[model samples]
Target: MLTSAWLDGLSLGDPIAADPLEGGYASRTFRVRTALGGSVVVKTQDNLPENLYALEADGLDALRAPGGFAVPEVLRVTPSYIVLSDLGTSEPSPTYREDAGRALALQHQQTADKFGYHVDNYLGTLPQRNPWTGDGHTFFAEHRLLRYLEEPNCHNQLPADDRRRLERIAGNLVNLVPVQPPSLLHGDLWHGNLLPAPNGGPAMIDPAVHYGWPEADLATLLIYGRLSDTFFDAYEEVHPPSPGWRARLPLLHLRELLCITAHWPDRAETVQEIHTILEQFD
Candidate 1:
């Protein structure tokens, strides 16, 4: 049995079972049940310079405040563990997918003034290396995506043509648009990180929380195959993607794909997918 020193305040009751939940790449997650009918999701990780659980707790609290989106209620957060409300066992509903766009608009409406967060955070256990200089293009392209591609893991995966194409795209992205005022973003809003609440609303978790362009969230959602078309429809109804947003998708996704490739070099399928997507832009 795994011990959580942070659970001292709450009555955990008799242990039922600790079943593994899928989709977290960095932290260990389990569905913990108690004999007294209480259940919660627990996430554990090694202590790092960034107290991610605490940051997540703060982010969730911000998102649950007045006029914020429906986010999970945080139960406890410590250096090694975080306990959170169990939204449920069910997968995200079509309603979630259908309404995701609108929901995101609502979430984005909850914004902050700064373009960057005060404290730096990680992306899946890896140092995200966001620029403190506050230059969005330089941060997104030069420091994040291009720097990751220079890694041997990414270099070996791309053919010469694809590398050239990626380089050109990266250069082009620098001048695409002036950075918009930063909004509070879920940071890593991929489909798997979102779950359905029992009451038919959407709940978010495992966020790489930050303040950045709203389009960054939309771009990440399009990379995975989970979001439904209804999501886009609903989103546009509330907050439409900016002009040339479609063209910028690959540029935004390049950072995420490179991050994954750097961390999970063995995932040849992911590398192949990156190649395929890059080919489309070329």
Candidate 2:
């Protein structure tokens, strides 16, 4: 429950109203109206990990550093809640997708010598381990794919044979994925994370930022089947994808499917999806 005292503590003006928002898996989100005659978005949760909100604020800053797309301005961030400047959104349009694609390509141009971030961050509520690794495939295998196997939901839900199959795929990742530079990845790129900016362009929110293979971000966007071909076309204009990337798409998305399965052990469809992908490689 949001109270006027909490808003007063932040000195963000008096709280007029706080309307509940949908689609927040990690926190309770609200579009808060203030007596200052402006509104902001507030995301709050109790007993969060020590640095969750702080790390998220850092990610938004890092994303903005590339000057590629628009990210919300972090007004105030505490362990329990964060206040951000409201960027009203609209429905997705072909032009918005095209703009977003080009923007994302430009963002990916900011590369690093190693594949990982300086510090680890969260993907949803799960800790995403990102130790600096020289090899891309090794980083993706160890940090992105295999790391989730330790979770109770992931370990218990998968049978012995299925686990072995996943391990086999991880071992063969070097052969399956292409050699690519360590590009800045949105880490959790999907349609839901991208809001339709009021400026008739794309605005990114809720990012899990890192430096890794750009194809991973592309794979995430493709898996949702929401964005159209126009986005890819625009992206290619700025930065073309590596050869054989299409064939590796399913394999690249394995990390996300694994993460979802961990968060929702009861979602049988996610388990089936994992099997479906594993079957493709066998």
Best by lDDT: 2
lDDT of 2 by residue, 172-210 (tens): 987788788899888899888888766767889888999
lDDT of each: 0.72, 0.87
Q: Which stretches of candidate 1 lie over 4 Å from their true place?
A: 4-6, 12-14, 46-50, 65-68, 90-95, 132-134, 150-152, 155-168, 177-179, 276-282
Best by TM-score: 2
TM-score of every candidate relative to the true structure:
0.84, 0.95
CA shift of 105, model 2, Å: 0.3
How well is each residue in 1-282 modelled by candidate 1, as lDDT tens digits? 456454556786754777788888768888888777878888886755447788878767756644335677788888878888888866555566665567778777766655566666778776655445455665566655677767777777767887777777677765664466566788888888777777666777877767677788888898675767888888888877677886777667777887888776586887777787777765
